[model samples]
Target: MKIIVFLGPSLPRSEAASIIDAEFRSPVAQGDVYEATLIRPDAIAIIDGYFGFQPAVWHKEILWAMTQGIHVFGAASMGAWRAVELGPFGMVGHGWIYEAYRDGRLEGEDEVAITHGPAAVGYKPISEALVNMRRTFASAADAGVMTVDTARQLVQIAKRQFFPKRDYEAVITAAQLPAAQAADLSHWIRRHAIDQKRRDASSLLHWFSQNINYLSAPKRVAYQFSATVFWAQAVELKRREMLSRYPGRKLDHARIEQFTRQTMGNADVQCRQQRLEQCKP
Candidate 1:
């Protein structure tokens, strides 16, 4: 059987198909529920990490796919929600479900309805499992069983596991990077974490404090090494060409590569992975 992947309007078919091997076929164009259902996709993957938000509006797409006897898998923001709606789908990186499962964190049924509305998708137990995974990854990170580099890789894997895109970017002015970088990282981390509501000023302060301690000589040195290797992998993968459009003028490939490489070595990368591993359901 072939898996026909349906991505949102902003993405191209070839780009979406790149993630799957023989299991995936040429992607069908489906910008929204109407066009999406018309393709009769065998499966649907909701990837909105690049948009930096969950496409909550697309929930019907999953139900429709199911109605058409199609399977669905989700990763990252959109994927987490999709997995809850469309059972038995894969999740890649850090997702809300992963976070709930990881940190022993659970919201009452009422809380879920705020976002998903009550539909009984077996999310309660999944939240518990996600919290357990969070603890496991936390223990692993603390014990040095999983280094920051390894954790980052896991985050990348998690992102790829559910989200369809290979990279995420924002259209900030060049002048914004100096200030935006820190905020961006913090926001991204919080988004990937299960305990988003708990991420207050104190949380930010504590995280920076620990991060300061972790960025010592050898640790920094090891991460730089890992960063280079990761950059090489992205290069080999030819990820730079995937972007169809960029705002604030044409995108800078070299700079993006550098930024991506630097992110691989950053402390937040570890947190993202650990959180996702903990949270993933």
Candidate 2:
């Protein structure tokens, strides 16, 4: 059985698949985790997910997946978001992004959120993530491309822009350092705009490959999962989606056609019989 990975922008399908031989699915949305658990995969790694307009994946779904004997792991992007909240409950969190969230050093969903292109383009990122910004600036300071204070200023410049419109060029321009300093910082950023999300995602993938057998281990949650009204409602929605999609139920076109004809014929006979009885004198 394949390990299921809920992935998107952070790690491209081709690159991530090469790192770990697992099924790569698109970013998790509202009901994705609950729906994925129906297959009972050995493990799941959530690396990226949807937000805004569409409903984001629920924390309860990740917990539910863990309770069903599946190893649930998360990192980078939305994965980092979920893992922080659910890590104490057996959801594995990986990478610096997750560490930041867990330690309360990095707070806020926007830190990881970035606007990107569609899947056809491999979710080509159009905006910079705050996580990447922090990494880039830290590296800049450490590398002497900028002073510690300068790096902090550039990071703040990035924070001022909306997440969707954020980019290295725009942020650097906003920094307004001296001409020589700006030139050095610009060259450094161009060469080293580390994509922290992708890096963290890769780390989780490596971890997933090394710990394949961990799926069988029992979790020690502080409490058991109760089917609260909210949880039940979410499950109901997932069930409806599953049923509507006709999962595992297949009828060939000819068989469906025959069934439809037989149904119509039965209706025709019933209608005629009723008319005949009504007209009887």
Top candidate when judged by TM-score against the true structure: 2
Off by over 4 Å in 1: 1-19, 22-33, 49-55, 85-141, 144-281
- Compute the lDDT for candidate 1: 0.34
After TM-score superposition, the amount by which residue 182's alpha carbon in candidate 1 deviates from its true location, in angstroms, is: 15
Candidate 2 worst ten-residue window by lDDT: 255-264
What's the CA RMSD for each of the models?
Answer: 24.0, 10.3
* lDDT (10s digit) by residue, model 2, range 160-195: 789999988888778777788878877888888899
Please tell me which predicted candidate would have the highest lDDT against the true structure.
Answer: 2
- Per-residue error for 2 in candidate 2, Å, reads 3.0
Error of 1 at 178 (Å): 23
- CA lDDT, candidate 1, residue 114: 18
lDDT of 2: 0.79
Report how far residue 265 has shifted in candidate 2, in Å. Answer: 42
